[model samples]
Every structure is written in C-alpha cells, then in structure tokens.
Target: MGLNIKNETTHELVRRLAALTGQSQTSAVEDAVRRRLAELEQQQSADEEERRRRIRAVIRRAQQLPSTGRTTEEIMDELYDETGMPR
Candidate 1:
C-alpha cells in the first residue's frame, strides 16, 4: 500500500525541484515532496521518542530528589550540566 497527497503545488516549486535533481519537472517535484515528507515524519517520530524519554527521566529523578525541595529549573540545570549539554 502507498499514500497519496493531492493538492495544487506551485509551478516554481516544481521547476526548482527539476533544476536541483536532473529529473523531469513532474518526477522531480513528486520525488522531492515525497522525500521531504518522509524526512519530516521520521524526525517527528524521533523527537517524540526523545521527549518521552526526557519526561520519564525527569519523573524518575524528581522521585529520588530530596523532599525538602529544589526548583524544577534547578533540577533541569543539574541534569543538563551532568549530561554535558554545554560541551
């Protein structure tokens, strides 16, 4: 099975696709649009997984931290520094 996108796309976009790839205008536009959509979807999935992992890590760390309390920002800063985010 395959997915189909239906809409009116600009001729200039089609032309640019053709120029960038060496394919016919229609084929270039179709391929370029398909490739870009696939990349965006894959990146979105990766980002969602990363976000979930971060949230879970935060939850676990919060449970372990002292009840006498540090701010959320402080906890996050500690995690970031520990992860060498500024490296």
Candidate 2:
C-alpha cells in the first residue's frame, strides 16, 4: 500500500525517527503507530479496570446501608402519611 504523508511536521518526525533509530522512514512510522496503538489499548484496559473498581465500591457501599426489608408499597405508604396525603 502507498502511504503518502502530506503533513510537513509528520514527514519531518518520520525522517528524524528513521535517522535516530537507523531504520527506514516506513519502518519508523510503522513502529510508532504500533507502539501508540499498544499504549492506547493499555490505557483503555486501565480505564475499564478503574470503572469496574468504582462500580464495585458503589455496590459495597449500597450493601452496607441498613435494609428495613420494607416492600415498595409499604415505603410509599409511609412517605405519603408523613406528607399528610390522603391514602
């Protein structure tokens, strides 16, 4: 496949990377792209783990709350009575 880099800065970076790494420009770009993809994947995995941790923490907190064992209807009735609403 033909990879035509149009951006001047990107072209310069590719050239510099190739020179520094003693590799072809194509190889440099490919290596950079692969490394960035790996980094992004790792970041995404970390973000997912963090999300799961937060959800677990929330579940644990909710579990610690006292449960009256009252049914939904019973709770609503109590609230209505407190508000002086007619049953």
Candidate 3:
C-alpha cells in the first residue's frame, strides 16, 4: 500500500523521524501513529473515569436528601378531590 503525504512539513517530519530512528519511512510513520493512538486512548479512558466519578458523587449527594416515603396516589390526594377534580 502507498500513502500520499502532500504536506511538505509532514513529509519532512516523517523523513526526519526515519533518519533519527534509523528506520524506513513506512516504519517511522507506523510507530508515530501507534504512539499517538495509544496516547489518545489513555486520555479517553481517563476522561471516562472522571465522568463516572462525577456521576457517582451526584448519586451520593442525592441519596443524602430526606425521603417523603409517600406513594403517588397519597401525594396526588393533596392536589385532587375524591372525584379526581383539582383541589
């Protein structure tokens, strides 16, 4: 397979990386891509963990509130009469 890298800067970077690492241009590109993908995946995993931590904190706070312990019908009685008309 062939890759078409039209950007001069990107082409130069790939060439430099290959020269520095003493590898072929294809190998340099492959290693760079893999390393970047690993970094992004790790970052995404950390973000997900932070999101879950926030959700758990919210749930814990909500649980600390007092419960009414009243059923829906019992509560509705406060707003409606026996004929189901609004009070």
Candidate 4:
C-alpha cells in the first residue's frame, strides 16, 4: 500500500517526475517500476534482442541449406542391408 524511499536524490527524482508528468508520486513510481519489470520479465533488453537476432540468423542459414531428395532411411539402405552390415 506504501513505499518508503530513504534516499533524498531518489525522492527528488520521483517528485520531479510527478510534477513533470502531472501524476501522483505513487503513479510515477508505479509506472517506472511496472515498465522496468515488464521489460525484465519479457526479455526486452539489448542482450535478448541480440540473442534473438542470432537465432534468426541461424534459422535463416538452416533454411538456405540444400535439401536432399533422399531420406535418411534411403541413405541407410544404400550403405547397409537388413542385417546391418555394410553393402
């Protein structure tokens, strides 16, 4: 229901935000905290963005690879028979 900010600088910043935005101090702090928490929980940081970029690049590269008309089973049939010995 309440928060106690002991730091004068932090208190002043909250007061400044409240005045500048015409919001209550609680609303200012709540907005700031909620935005940051959402970012943290949703992985909206730069590192997360870079990681997603890398994963996308990998997916793109994989999709660009040439496809073989033969399946793995077909290749195995060429290399080995029903007895599991090399042909």
* lDDT by residue (tens digit), candidate 2, 43-81: 999999999999999999999999999998898887788
Candidate 3 regions with alpha-carbon error over 4 angstroms: 72-87
In model 2, pairs of residues that clash are none
Candidate 2 residue 35 Cα shift, in angstroms, is 0.5
Per-model CA lDDT versus the true structure: 0.81, 0.93, 0.96, 0.92
TM-score of 1: 0.52
| lDDT winner | 3
lDDT of 2: 0.93
Residues 1-87 of candidate 1: C-alpha lDDT, one tens digit per residue: 764445446667776778888899768867877999999999999999999999999999989977856887787786777666952
Please give the lDDT score at residue 7 for candidate 4. Answer: 100
The TM-scores, one per candidate, come to 0.52, 0.78, 0.78, 0.49
C-alpha positional error of residue 85 in candidate 1 after TM-score superposition, expressed in Å: 43
Candidate 3 achieves a global lDDT of 0.96
lDDT of 1: 0.81
> What is residue 75's positional error in candidate 3, in angstroms?
7.4
Please give, for residues 28-74, the per-residue lDDT of candidate 4 as tens digits.
99999999899887876777889999999999999999998899899
Every model's Cα RMSD, please?
A: 12.9, 5.1, 5.0, 6.5
